[model samples]
Target: MDKAKVLETRRLLAFIAVFEEGSFTAAAARMGMAQPALSIAISKLEAQLGTPLLIREPRGVKATAAGLLLSQRAYEIIGLIESTVEEVATVEQHPTGEVAIGLPSSTAAVLAIPLVERLAKTYPGIRLRLVESFSGYLWDWLLNGHIDIAVVFNQASRPEIISTPFAWEKMHLIGKALPGEANAPIEAGQLTGLPMVMPSRKQSFRDTIEHHIQKQGGTLDVQIEIDAGHQLIKLICSGRFYSILSPGSVAHEISTGQLQARPLAQPLERAICLAQRRLRHQATAVRCVTDELLSEARALIVAGVWDARIEAPLCT
Candidate 1:
């Protein structure tokens, strides 16, 4: 079988939809196709690959390991194709292209607005798509061709992910106002006793926090684990539990006087970077977006819009 025929976009998308929806009937409904047609597509794909991807259960269906792997890669494949088409259609003067950027919630809160505003004014023809996720997933998306660029707190040790230093972000311990000491810096040793909520271990930031605590002869007293950034910010605003985060993640709450934050006595810092896929054809639109992100972020820092410090190699 020809390799090109083996990985048809339609079939890959169909299989991924089924894998996500967990049933051909449901996937087909979501995709606006007949259930039998969806099933046939999946079967044809399996035949071409010479492997069974679906394990039909009593109630619905589940993807086998192979199916899951393909589903993950399929996202990248489809995204790359879309980006390539858009890039080719884009012009230099009237650069009309779409750039997909994955940013952590912290960075997204601070950079997304300014970046969008700048791009809108500078290159109105360019379209921007912002995705917020933990650093680990962002790294994977960058590697797998799911995103054009990423502004991440921590980068993965992948040679294929080209990174340029963006800035140094200071982490904070945020929650209810302390008893008569609202401005007091929270000590690392004391953090082991505070009830906290943070991202799950799947997120690289959580591990970074834990590693910092352990190095300081303490540990995170995490009461709950959640991966969503908005929920974590909501928890900080609730004041019921304390969480380690950057001020940028909850800038609205902090600015509105709805929340209070203090830097750790032993400040925890993470280096943020602008990462792109190495050895891949990078679109000019993508480069323009990346440049805009750095510029906006630096301006925000200098203007105190974001409580982060700009590090070396600030531009490009």
Candidate 2:
């Protein structure tokens, strides 16, 4: 048999319908065709294949052995075709199927929580996945297609990725001061001799802090180097060490007295940027997530909930 002649789509459909409905009359009604026409179509289909396709009884019909074999193959083919149609339609409508985002751990905790919640509520079907890593790792993942977008520091060197400033946060010192020192405003040099829990120097914020310290002719007395914001907060609250972070990460802690946030006399600010691979088209889901993150960031800035001075930067 010619493979092309044997694989008639309409014949396979007709055959399956009859097999499923158990009679030509029933199949015809389901298919919106007359019983005689449906029977004729089935007869012609079986004759073309040179096989007895059905066993007729008084009340209904059953597939002959050849009919049973063809039925299985027909189902597989029909399923694939239907799946292909759905996939094509989905691609046409959304263009991007799903989006994965890489975010800094601190940013995910302080900024991404509400954005993700809003996304779940508003666009439930748009598949969104997040991987929380440090800035360096997140940057690598974004460029490698492990993630579609990244929320990261503006200072990261990624000429290959398109970076846009989405938000800005001022860095601040967080600590549990000794008696009477909590309310006293301390100079940048005052932090020199204190035991400090600081982020790894590889972090952009660490560089900013170090720059400010040197400008003030002071040095950071590093007792611990922890990268995660919550861990830094916990260490500070335990009165074991003092750490520096963007005010956004510790605002709630300061407000609740779990920690105290003080402005550094020397201003240190970091821009937060949304990045995607350069020249790569973004999906609807990625765009939606980025928009929501910016919205939440603005709200936090306005409400002073994050305890930071927020600035919007102009991108050239």
Candidate 3:
């Protein structure tokens, strides 16, 4: 870009913000800039271009035909600038800055610790923010830009969103084992007789488990509904009820004999995915965290720590 174009970049950015926000005052607030400064920049841009770019009104503002054209091109210009800055920052693409990851509470129980440990060792400069919530909330956060990456049981389809099939978190039937009855596989039909404490209908896992049970000519007789993952496990551990969950969720209890889990004879599994917005300028930190998640998941599968099939490699 020439010096004149470089000097006019700030005006284009202001105009872009104003055009998107539909009001000069709102755009100034978003940019943390003075309203008069943005107005001056937009005015200068219009003067140089010799066209009225915005139509100001009492309600707000609307983009003129010229303004709409500039807005479309400005997005491309800004995207390229951001990509260039990141490329010049690190030749080897060392990840820096913050990366946000959203996980379902149950999935986090098993995956979060190891993933965090690996990231801490591999990228000392990169920061990680972990958000645990239901899949629905996580999806909303991912779409709204509150989180950069998410591990969800269900994949989402949209123009702005993308998902990678990372692995499958195997769902197991959980109960307090009868004395001397080792953890072993159980026939799917037996699940219909067990009194169950389950995730609410809104939880995707519940849908997955129920669908599997129905396929087996049985139904989940959920006597109680618990929205929280840990509490659901605790309720099952109390010996009064049963619940189906990933073995990874109660790994410690299963290992130490406080609880027992059995895989269904007819297997049921939850698909685990890494989701992110399809950004024009992908961040190095996001890729670093994503790579670490896959690496840790693979190691866990190899070491028998997590009972999941490696469906896809990093970012696959």
Considering lDDT, where higher is better, how would the candidates rank from best to worst? 1, 3, 2
lDDT of each: 0.79, 0.72, 0.78
Candidate 3's TM-score reads: 0.71
Model 1 ranges off by over 4 Å: 1-92, 279-281, 312-316
Clashes of each: 0, 0, 0
Q: How close is candidate 1 to the true structure, as a TM-score?
A: 0.69
Put down candidate 3 lDDT per residue, 66-130, tens digits, no spaces. Answer: 87777766756765666567768876857678888988877787788988888899998888899
RMSD (Å) per prediction: 7.1, 18.2, 6.4
**Residue 43 error for model 1, in Å?**
29
lDDT for model 3 = 0.78
Q: For residues 167-196, what per-residue lDDT tens digits would candidate 2 score against the true structure?
A: 677666777664235545457777778788
